[model samples]
Target: MPEYQIFKNIQKHISLSDSERQLFISLVVEKDIAKKEIVLEQGSISRKLYFVEFGSLRAFNVNEEGRESTIMFAVQDWWITDMNSFINQKPALLSIETLEVSRLIEFDFSTLEELYKRLPKFERFFRIIFQNAYIREQLRVLDKISFTTEQQYTRFVEKYPQIVQKVTQKQIASYLGVTPEFLSAVKKK
Candidate 1:
């Protein structure tokens, strides 16, 4: 396998020997998804976690009124998946779709299980990843409940300028819990 962002991502978190690294790389599979492709749809089981090598993706859900609420966006070097579905092998409530033609590396759950069993350090690697994910979710929840709209938008723009630039104005508004008009007014000031 050629060198990819996934290798750098894992190395940043955990040190792996040459053999272990090869094994890990062997388990990964790559795919190219076109824009508007739905990788994981609502009610489908999410069997793999995807690492974005290039381009962007968004996770979202539609409510009874048929409004789409953006949950999260993953760009280059970021990992995205439906956590509950991937972990429990249950149906996902969110849909993960590509926003642009993208290259992603998928980590299969069963293969990861084997990695954890065969290499203990990988367990630490996943633990750190999951822990950070949980913490980020918690902090995002707090931010939504406490921060003003402008504050949230400012932080969102600062943290994910690439996402903001790639997604449509309406999508960004939905993600920020604001109306498109409001977002436009905010942008003006």
Candidate 2:
């Protein structure tokens, strides 16, 4: 199985026994997603967490004006989901879509619950994953409040050079809370 990528991601914080690894592999479903495919739409209940095996995805929200505000980008080895909705089984605040043709490992919430029961170690792994995700988002918020637009752009580039190559300036601008025109100017400087 081409599931080694997911195993590698899991191994970052937790070690799994051979049988536990096999069980995890059995629970996840691998999917081939096309470019621009919306995996989770706003207002729908979020049920799955997607791990990018390859390619890229973005989570963003559209306002009443239909303007998109990017929340985050996920490249290979990264996980993306509408965390609030997924955790609570509520309507999603963000929509997740692929930026490129992608392969992903999908874990349904029920399956995760099962995994947690069968292997308590998975709970620790996910706890750490959520903590790291929270920290990254907290830092992003701090950056927005503390840095200039150019500095924000620079930090974003330094942090996600792989994503910068995969997505458009408009998308990057949305993530940075700026207009595409403004991003163009930032790039010029």
TM-score of each: 0.94, 0.97
Give the runs in model 1 whose Cα sits over 4 Å from its true position: none
Put down candidate 2 lDDT per residue, 21-72, tens digits, no spaces: 8888888899999999999999999999999999899999999999999999
Residue range 24-115, candidate 1, lDDT tens digits: 87777889999999999988999989999999999998888988889899999888999999999999989999999999999889888888
Candidate 1 versus truth, CA RMSD in Å, comes to 1.3
Per-candidate count of clashing residue pairs (backbone under 3 Å): 0, 0
lDDT winner = 2
What lDDT, from 0 to 1, does candidate 1 have? Answer: 0.89
lDDT of each: 0.89, 0.92
**Stretches of candidate 2 exceeding 4 Å from the true structure:** 1-3
After superposition of all CA atoms, the RMSD between model 2 and the true structure is 1.0
